[model samples]
Target chain A: MLTRFENRPHALDVIGVSVAFGEVCVIDNVSFHVDVGSTLAIVGRNGSGKTVLLKALIGAVRASGTIRWAPETRIGYVPQKLDIQRDLPLTGRDFLNAKADVARAPATDAQRVAGLVNLSQSIVDQPIGTLSGGQFQRLLLAFALVGTPSVLLFDEPTAGVDEPEEKSVYALIHQLQQNEGLSVLVISHDMTQVQASADHILFLSHHGSYFGKTADMLNSERLQELHGPTVAHLRE
Target chain B: MTYATGPGAFLIPLGMAAAAGLMGSIAVMRRMALASDALSHIALPGIAIALLVHVNPFLGGLIALVLGTVLVWAIEYRSRIPTDVVVGVIFSAALAMGSLLASGDELIEALFGAPNTSDSFNLIGLGAASLVIVFIVRYRSQLVIRLVSPDLARPAGINVPRLDLLYLLAFALTIALGLRYLGVLLMGSLIIIPAATAMRLGTNLRTMQTISVAIAMLATLSGMLLAPVLCLAAGPLVIVIAASIFFLSLAVRRA
Candidate 1:
């Protein structure tokens, strides 16, 4: 029996999604759906295709299947590379002066600094080149906040950030979800952030694996068989 | 701070070089550096064939540009050549065919390369001519950065393959025209090197890009003077200077 996940579309849905690079399939014949305003976290090993799956959903990277975003869906993404380019001439102002309107106005250096209150103001006027790692990440985060995207995708959001900074990021994400009901999808290996933020977890193994509530997914027998009850121990 | 000695002698190379730098930087950052170069080489066959057929080289380059972009996209997105290796083969073959096809009296000059006989007036005038296209696609520069962030660029509604096409067309036109000044062997290098050198030191994309243009401008002026003094080919000389800048930045990065 086929699941109706493919038959009809919600706000955003993926059916029979298959993405491949060379001979190997990263996302092999997978299908999933997300309800409006729900948060889903994808978990897997480094090469386990979680990122590919997320990318497929956003229709960025190619996949063979149907991925329908809700009408007028504006998707935001923060890539794995945080310190992307500090040397671009754009002041923080230039970054916000973009197509989307997720953040507050004034979109100037001062406003951007105020928005990213974590950084000093002097660096705000400085061209993007001089930023530290956290600062760069902050800049992209601010960009992500712009345009009030209907959905947000963070690919390894905390990969290089410090622990405290990760907490701040999670805090911001939580605020977005709570205040605006921002439909968010996070791809990460960090167990705690997933447990903390993810309402739903999609554990993608070599093939499409699990999709359910985070707690339920964690409590599943396969996870226990694979990781020897580390998920249970983390409950404490 | 090493400024050129001659009055406005820098303008000629500056015009062509800056255009090349901007285009090439996008190519390099997108990891489509080889693809752009290959497309440039591919233009050779089209232009040469067009010349044989008594048509416009620019028109020919356009055809090559279309085919080149499609070929790379097919090889890159659709096929399994691992992107990098595929482009490598594409460029080598394209350059070979370009060299072989662009034969005749103009052929020698094209392959071995030639110095631009176009005066400062002509070069600067052409630069002005190209500004409209630049202004129209200015939004593209911002969008291009997203392409560099393979993770971020695509989902932002930036069709990667389409941008690749746009880039290939722009590069083909630029490359076909630029070959007159920068020449075949070294034009591709000059197009992208200044920006790449700056990327080493600069922390932000904008600063790196600005400095890249500035550096390319400097290298061009210096090469003009240095080529005569050392009795060397202008293109290779200019490339050497640019290469030195890259190494200098890498050293500074390590230091």
Candidate 2:
């Protein structure tokens, strides 16, 4: 069941976001706005700077532009992939509690978050290194949700999950967005998922880019010329 | 032969073991175990130089190892070169310099350790112990977060660079603390073996830290205890015990 978001005034304004490494301008003058309770999907092929744009949004990467977060805006970021060492003894609960104060009764807080992510207490107790890809992804989501941030950012949200698991994860995300009035910004490679999950699309390519309603993204002449044959299916 | 050992026999190795064990939990997790070996080797030339100049060899070794750590960090941070490769270069250069500076008895002493005695030595040991404790208490969580991903940690407002420099300094100090006891060739074992053993035995971060310290202390104590009986040097013996414990933990896990 999709829950509807409550009315909340929240916004993210990124203006002329540009990132360059030496001679290469990876994210060249990209800009967009995300309204509260909306999902914005950033789409691009590999090496098109989608990830760089995400990093720029969080101030993790230095960029020559303005990223204005609304006053009192809290952001939660779920990395596309965490390089978890196979031998590391960190558990799901520990991962969620990493940023929390130890004196704050993290065990109970972690359990609450685990439940929010639809994970059982036992699964949260298991070593993170031993978790399956889908399970780990859910744990990452739970970890992000620990602080109850108004904005949730995900990078390649379903990169390694199976098809069925991916759908379920997206459904969960949709429910959370509607229920929490959370603003979501995600980078995705799957155009079909982006179309279904995102309210707006930001399509990026080496030559040019477009940002508009999901329904209008494929019709943009700039995207058509830049993406050409590789993205023709997006029109459907 | 009568056992020619002093308070340093226990204090130096035990203090070093504690510091090394803590550092090991981070280093082993990052797969930088061999970097410790490289850093220790990089200290050998410094030790040789210190011997020639009649300066405190521990200070010289600490400076050299810290420089090596900084170089490795800088190179790994700036370029795509693998950490072990950069460390390997430093290790080889230090080895060549060490050989050029000292040989025969001096080389053997530098490699196997000699009796160290100073009226103020206990203060140094106490200081190292306090610093390691404070480090583990204050930054253990931050270190773990950074270990998971710098991208995540940075957004969470962790001072990643400061934390990194702090860890490296602690690592350098740990290696230097062990220099008079374990020597260059054997010191890195103290930093890796316990953590490996703990990884095999532990189920979480807290247990891993506890077990790492326990195993390191046990190995140091047992090796010192057996040193007199076997007529072997304590530094090398402690390392042997630690390795034995690691293999034993492996066997135990398999069982």
Candidate 3:
């Protein structure tokens, strides 16, 4: 899918990057590169340091070794389901306006990104706590889109959304990638979406990791060894 | 002692109450209700020490509150402990120590506040209260983002640690502003009750803040006016009014 970007400049490069908390080594010697305007899917089982790896890439956590991004790279991050109180007084518009103000984006950017995510004005005006799971996901997407970031990092973007809305969320990400020319790094458990959208797959596990083209990784035996019998369905 | 009852006397408390409303809204949203309440108690020991040393108790309380804020921030940052836990342990100790140091009427006044005896420090308190309001309004966007998630705020170009420090400082200042009227025992109530009420009734950020400020000012005005008439202390009366509003807000169903 991303073959067109084979000759494009690298958006990110990771060399022997490792993160450890005290005695526990989470991610060790992980290395990969993402091309501009391509999507890289990070697939792994729970507690496999997938979220930690994303944090390292975004400088949210301490990691040893080299992880570099293209000069002037701006990243927008969408984290997993946040434990927001149902009675929280913040509206979606307030959340978006906060991002716009901090990012120093124009006043119009909030409306533009809200439109991009297909969030209605009425929905955006409602308190964030009252928003449905899918609406909250869209709000986060609009938040990420506000600064016109060149790259996006999503950690289980649709974790709490319904099955029907999950597909639309990925579709929105795909559409945004095409329209905005974004490079995406996402962590997800849904392999079907990965096969549909990802140019490359980075399979991380307690044993080791495999980083390569999506098709090749799906076909490789190492994926079976690292992912066990679970990934056997992907070969079909 | 001749207590100041001029119109000028009312201005500082009103401004301080408004600042408490604004600061408390963020504090409650951050889920720091217990921590903020405990944080005011840290001022008690400072007041006791100031009385012993023959210094202005307000200055002493302000210094102690600032120091306590920094300590809480540092411990929370270094150990990854929750802010409430850190504040709880530290401020509780301060309260115990304060009770031991001051005695009789002086201690009673420090814990529950006394009527204003002089207007000499009113100007400085008003200025400090204005600074806190300005800080909350100017940096509310950043504060809101940080409250939601530090990771999101960091990516959006906010310095999360620095913002946290500044916010804690503003919170301390607001508490200090109200200490004269509400005392260490009741100041935190003024901050939390109005914001908690606003959280229940407000549909959005703007509404929440507006309602919180209005409730705070109303409570302050009513308590200040009614305390002398009813032969009651203003600090307890103000908190009672704020708590009453909070209880009343429970009756109005949220939209």
Which model is ahead, 1 or 2, in terms of TM-score? 2
lDDT of 1 by residue, A1-236 (tens): 53322243355777888899779888877766676677778877678888778767766667998887889887777777654443444555445554242133344533543364355556555665556666667767666655566787888776777888877877877776777777788887777878887777877777456677777777788777765454665353
**Who is ahead in DockQ, 2 or 3?**
3
Candidate ranking under TM-score, highest first, comes to 3, 2, 1
* Native contacts kept, each candidate: 0.34, 0.50, 0.81
10 residues in a row with least lDDT, candidate 3 chain A: A227-236
lDDT by residue (A1-236, candidate 2, tens digit) is: 32232244447888888899889899888877887888899888899998888888887788998899898787778899776877677777677777664223355667777888899978887778888899999998887776677889999988899999998888888888888889999888777777787877888888766788776676777667778764587776
Docking class of 3: high
The deviation in Å at residue B77 for candidate 2 is: 2.5
Across A1-236, the per-residue lDDT of candidate 3 in tens digits comes to 53677799999999999999999999989999999999999998899999999988877899999999999998999999887889999999999999999888998899999999999999999999889999999998899888899999999999999998999999999999999999999999898888889998888888877799888887787677767565776665
lDDT of 3 by residue, B1-255 (tens): 223277887898899999999999999999999888999999988899998998888888998999999999999999999998999999989989888989998888888877574647888998999999999999999999888888888778888889999999999999888888888989999899999999999989999999999999999988888887887778788999999989989999998
* 10 residues in a row with least lDDT, candidate 2 chain A: A1-10
For all the predictions, what are the DockQ values?
0.28, 0.51, 0.82
User: Candidate 3 — what's its lDDT?
Assistant: 0.90
RMSD of 3: 1.7
Ranking by lDDT: 3, 2, 1
Best by lDDT: 3
Off by over 4 Å in 1: A1-11, A14-32, A44-48, A64-66, A81-117, A123-133, A190-192, A206-208, A214-231, B1-15, B28-39, B46-66, B80-84, B98-105, B112-137, B196-255
lDDT of 3 at A83: 79
